[model samples]
Target chain A: MMRLITSGAGALLGGLMMLAGVTGPAAAQGTGSATLDAVKTRGQVLCGMSGSVPGFSLPDSQGVMRGLDADTCRAVTAAALGDAAKVKFVATTTQNRFTALQSGEVDMLSRSTTWTLGREGNLGLMFAWVNYYDGTGFLVKKSSGVKAAKEMDGATICVQPGTSTELAINDYYRLNKMKFTPILIQDQAEIQGAFLSGRCDAYSTDASALATFRFSQGPKADELLLLPDIISKEPLGAVVRKGDDKWFDVVRWTFAAMITAEEKGITQANVESFLTSTDPDIRRLLGIEGDMGKALGLDNKWAFNVIKAVGNLGEMWDRNITPMGVPRGINNLWTKGGLQYAPPLR
Target chain B: MADTHADPRMSSARSSPKRSMSFAWSDPAFRAIVWQVLIVGVVVGVIWYLISNTANNLAARRIATGFGFMDRIAGIPIGESMIPYNPAEHTYGRALLIGVLNTLKVAVIGVVLATLLGTVIGIGRLSKNWLVAKITAFYVETIRDIPLLLQLLFWYTLLQGLPSPKQALRIGDAVFLTNRGLKLPLLVWEWQHTMVLATLAVGLVGVFLWSKHAKQRQDATGVRPATWPIGCGLLIALPAIVGIVLGAPLEIELPVLRGFNFQGGLTISPEYFALLLGLVVYTAGYIAEIVRSGIEAVARGQWEAAGALGLRSGMVLRLIVLPQALRVIIPPMTSQYLNLTKNSSLAVAIGFQDIVSIANTTLNQTGQAIEGIAVIMAVYLTISLSISLFMNWYNAHIALVER
Candidate 1:
C-alpha cells in the first residue's frame, strides 16, 4: 500500500513536470504554434464580435449577422476555407474579449477594438490590421445650442466606462480646461437612456459609433448633431491570440486582399469578368496566374474565393454602413485620397 | 512466561499482516487522506503548469510580468476621483489607490443607508396596518427579483430623465435636483469649527459612557433612566452650546442658481447619486428579508411574557424582543455588508470611477493584468475580512450565554 501511494505521487509529479516543459516552449515562441496549424487544417474560422454595435457587428432584418466587421470575418473565411459561411461568430464584450481569445473560445476577434501597445504586448494578442479609422466625437441635441465641445463649459458628458472613449473625453476636457460632469454607464442600453433622457448634455464616443447611434435613434435622431471635434485617433482592428503566426498571416492577407481588390477596381459583380481579364495585377490578385496564396500556405485561388464569397471592401461598406450615412472618408482607398493602402501582393 | 497472555494478539495478528495492510488501505480515514492528497496534487500541478506556461508565454511575447509597472506614470485621465490625480504625473499605483478610496466611499455610505431603510421596511412588513404591510411586501418583492445591474440602469435613466441643470427643480433656497446631479448646502467652516467638532466628538463619547452607567444603575436600583432625553442633551444640546461658545463656528454655503446651474455648494454627481440609490434600494430588499426572518425567529411567548409584565407593546418590543432578535440579525447582516462592498465593484460598469474602474485603466495602460487583478482581489478580500472581524466581535458580545 505504501509503495503504491509513493509510486502514484511520483507519477503525478512526473506528469506535471512533463506538461510544464512541453507548454513552456510553445508559449515562449509567442507566435506560430500548433493551434494556428490546427486552425488551418480545420478550414473554418471562429470570429469574436460584439452583438449590438450597429454598422459594425449587429444582425440584419433577416436575422443574419451582417456588418462591416462581420463581412471582414466572412471574407477571411472565404479566403481560407473557400466558403464565407464556414465562420462562426461568438458574441463577446470588452471585458470578455481577451479572455475568450486567450482561452481558445474564438479564433479571431473582429470586434471594433483599438490597437493599443499595451494590448499588443500584455494580452498575448496580435493585431492584424486596422479595419476602421475612428476618432472620439460628441453628439448633443441641437436645441442645447452647443456648437462645439468647448461651448458647454460645464456640460455633462455621458460615455461608456472602461473604454478608450472615456479616457479620451476626459483628456479633451482637461486639456481644454473645461470642467464637465461625466455620466459613466457600462452597458449599451444605459448609455442610450442617459443620452436620450437628457441626463447628459453631450454623448461622446467614436465618430462611427455616433453615426450608427444617430441612424438607429428612430425619428428623434434628427434633433441631435455630432460635433466636428475629433479628439483622438481610434484605429479599430481585428486581433488574434499571440503564438499563431500561420493564422495571423491568413487573417492579415484576407483584409489586405479586400483593400487591394478595391484598389484594383474589382467588385464582386465584376470579379468573374476580371478573373478572365488580361490585366496582370487583377489576374495575379484573383490568383489566375500567381503563387501568392501558396506562399501563405493557402490555395492559389484564395482571393477569388474571398471576392466571390463576400464582395470587395467597397461593397461591404456600402451594404452595411452606407445606410447609416457614414461617409467612406478616411476608410476609402488610397487612390481616392484616403489613408487605406495595401502592400503589393507580390 | 512473563507475558504469555498478552502474546496471544502478537501470534493472532501475525497470521494476517497482508490482510491488515489491505484493510488499512480501504479504511475510510486512509481513503480520505488519499483522496485529499490526490485532489490537492492534481490542482496544484495544474496551477503550476499554467503559471510556468504563462511565464514562458509572457517572456516570449516580451511582456514583463510584475508589479513594477504600477510605478509607471498612467497617461490616462480619470473622470472623478476623491483625491487629486494627474494621469501624466502620477503612477498607476496612486491612481489605483484613488479608485480604492472611491469604492470604499460608496460601500460605506450604501451600507449605512441600506441598513436603515431595510430595518424600517422589515418592521413595516410586520405592521398591523394592512396598507403598510402590503406596500412593504411589494417593495421587497419587486426590487429583489430584478437584477441589480438593470436596476442601476433604471435609476441612472430616471436621474437623467430629470430636467436639465438650467431648469433644475429647486426644493428650497439651498437645494436643487437636475439631470446633472443633486446640489445641496455645504458647510462653510470657520477657524472655530475645530473646537466645535472636537466638543461634539467628546460629547458623543460621554453619552455612550452615560448610557452604559444608566443601564447598570437601572439593573441595580430599579430606576428607569430616560435614555432619549440624555441622548438628545448629549448629542444636540452639547454640540449647540459648544458652537455658541465658539461663536458659531460655521455658516451654511447655500447653492444659488447662476447662469446654467447651481453654484457655490457641494454637488453630488448624477453617477454617485444613481449608484447610491440603486445599491441602497437593491440591498435593502435583501436586508429586509433578513431582518424580518430575524424578528420572526424570536419566540412569540417572549413578547407575550413582556406584555404580561405590564409593559406596552412598543416598550416590550424595544426592551425584550430587539435584543434577542439582534443576535440573529447581525451575523447575516455582516454578510450583507460584505455583499455591498463586493457589489460596489459593479460601479465600474456605470463609470462610477470606483476602484475597479481605475484598476482597469491602469491594467490597460501598464499591460500588467496579473498585478491589476491582484490589486482588485486584494482590496475586496481586505474589505471583506475587516467587516467580518468587526461583526464577529459584535456577534460574540451579543451572543446568548447559558450555564
Candidate 2:
C-alpha cells in the first residue's frame, strides 16, 4: 500500500515537473552561461544578505538598506558594473543562503555568514574574504552578576536555532561540566524578547550581534552586560558559488582594496585625489598604472568605483557599526594588531 | 418526419456510405488513447529535461549530493527530547529521530485532548441551558477565527511574562509556575516500579479478554453479563493490590528552587507548553463544530425511540446517537487529525524541536537542502499515511450496514 501511494505521488510530481519545464524555459538559462555574463545581461548584481540584523543588513527609515552586508553588495556592484547603486539585495536566512546562491537565485551572498571547512570544502561555496572577525559571546542581565561565561554554569540560555552559536554554547557548557538548559528560538525578535522577559538567564549569539541587540532593544544598554569572554572564532565573510574563479577574484579583491585603502589613509573623500599620487602601488590600485582591472575583466576604475561608493573599510565600519557601540577591536587593520590585513595591491 | 419515415430504405442507404468510410477521429476510444499517449509522452519528456537540468546545475555548482552527512555529528542542542540525546555523541540522524519522536508526542497528546474537549463542548452546544449553549457557541466562534500561529505566539509571550523562577507561583512546594517552565513533582522509581508496570500490563490484557468473553456469553445465552465491575477489578484494582503488596516503590521528586531555576522535577518548557496549549485550543474549536454537526446528523426519531424504550439519556446517546453519528464524524475527524499533525510543524516557529524544524537546522548546517527536505517529506508522508490507514480501518468497522 505504501509503495502504491509513493509511486502515485512520484507520478504526480513528474507531471508537475513537466509542466514547469514546458512553461518556464528561461529558468534553465542561468546554467547555460556564466554568472558574470548573466549578471551583466541582467544589468544588476543580485546580492544575497541577512536583512534583519541591526548593523548588518537592516533597512533604514527611508527604506534604503544600510549595514556592512549591504555595503558589501554595493561594493560588488560598483566594481562589476561601475554603478554601486545598481544592486538588488535578496534577503536570506541561514537556511536558504547557500541554496539561493547555487541555484542562481542570487549572484553572490554578502550576509555575515561564517566561513567553515564544511561550507568551503564540501558545500561548494568559497569564502572571498573575512570581512568581519567575530566570535560567540553570552548576553546576561547586569543583575545576574555573571562576569564571564564560566560563571554561567547552571544557567538557562536562549540561542537561535540552526546557527553556529547554538553549538558553541553547548560546547562551552559541556566542557565546563555544568548542567544548563537551552531555549532554542528561531526569530531574532522572539529571542530578544525572551531574554528581556527573563525567560532565559542569558542570550547567546555573535558578539557584534549581541552588542547590536543589546544597544538597540533592551532595558537599557547599561542594564545588560555582554560577557567579555569570546569563546568560538566566527570568521564572517562573503560567500560565492564555487567553480567561478573569475567572479571569486573580483569579489576577493574588492574586499582587499577596501582594507588597503583604509591602511593607506585613503578615505572615500580622498579616493579620487589619489589618482595622481606618486606611489606606484596607489596608482596601480586606482587603475592608473597596471592592468589589474583588465585582468578581472572589469573597467579600469573598478576599485576606484568601489571606494567612492562604499568608502574605505574604516569609513564603512565607522559609519554603520560604530553607532551600535561595537568597537573595532579584532576588526582593525593588520598593522594595528588586528586580523583584517588586505593583500598587497600589486 | 413523415417523409423520412416513409423513405427508410433511402435513409439507410445514405447513412451506409458515411459509416463505411469513417475516420478514426470519430472513434471515442481512439481519441482517448491518443490524448493519453500525448499527455504521458509530454510528462516523461518534461521529467527527463528537469532531471538532466538539475544534475547539470548541481554539477556545475559543485553541490554535493548524498545522504552521508546524516552520520556527521549534529552539534546543535535540542531543548526537549523523549529519547536520550547528547549533542556531542549523537549523529544528525539521531537528532532528527528525536525530533520525530517529539513531534509524535505533541501530535498524539494534542489529538486525544482535542477530541475530548471538542466532544464535551459539542454536546454542550446542544444543551437545553441557555448559558451553556451560548458559552460553547462563543468559544467555538472566538477560537476558530484567530489564526493558530498568532495564537501560538500569544501563548508563548504570555507564558514568558510570568514571574521569574525565584518569584514563581508555587503550590504546596510541589508545583511551580515560572517564566522558565511549569515544574511538577515526578515519580522517582526504584526496582519494584518495574514489577508494578508489568503487573499493570498483564491486568490490562486480562481485562480485554474478559470483556470479549462476556460479549460472547451474552450473544450465546441472551443474558448480558455485567463486565464493568470485572473490568475495574482486573485493570485497576488488581494492579494496585499487587503494586501495594510489593511495597509501592515510587517516590516523588518534588521541585526545589536552586540558584537561578527549579531543579529535580519534570519541567515542561514554555515552548512545549505554548505549543500544546495553542494546538489544543485552536483544534478544539474545529472539533467542537464537527462534533455538533455529527450529533445533529442523527435523526431525531432514534433518540425519541431509545428514550421510549426505557433507556436513560446516557445509554441512549451511547447506544443509538453515537453509533450512527460517528459514521458522519469519523471521516472529517481523520482530516482534523492530519491537520493537527501537519500544524505541529509550526513548532519550529515557537522553538519546539519538531521533525521539520530539526531537519531545517540540519539542512542549514550541512547545506543539503534537497536531502533535508526529502527526509521531512518522507517522514510526514509516513505519518500521514499511517494515520489515514488507521482512521480508514476504524471508519470501515463503524460503517452503516443495510440488511
Indicate which candidate wins on lDDT: 2
> TM-score, chain A, per candidate?
0.88, 0.89
Worst 10 residues of 1 chain A by lDDT: A1-10
Instruction: Give, for candidate 2 chain A, the lowest lDDT window spanning 10 residues.
Output: A1-10
Candidate number achieving the greatest TM-score relative to the actual structure: 2
Please give the TM-score that candidate 1 achieves against the real structure.
0.86
**Number of the top-ranking candidate, with DockQ as the measure:** 2
* Tens-digit per-residue lDDT, B295-361, candidate 1: 9999999988998999998999888988899998999999899988988776755568888777765
Those runs of model 1 whose alpha carbons end farther than 4 Å from true positions after fitting are: A1-36, B1-43, B60-63, B77-79, B215-234, B245-249, B256-261, B308-315
Tell me the lDDT of model 1 at A234: 95
Question: How much lDDT does candidate 2 score?
Answer: 0.84
lDDT tens digits, residues A1-346, model 2? 1222222233234333433333122332432326666777889999998778989899999999999999999998999899988999987666666766766668899887888898887678999998789999988999887898888777888887768887778888779877678887676677788899998999889998889988886458899999999999999999988877778888999999998898888888989889889999889889998988888878888899999999999898998899998889989998998888887877
Please estimate how well model 1 matches the true structure, expressed as its whole-model Cα lDDT.
0.79
Clashing pairs in 2: none
Q: Stretches of candidate 2 above 4 Å error?
A: A1-33, B1-38, B219-222
> Across residues B338-375, which tens digit of lDDT does each residue of candidate 2 receive?
99999998786677889987887787788776777789
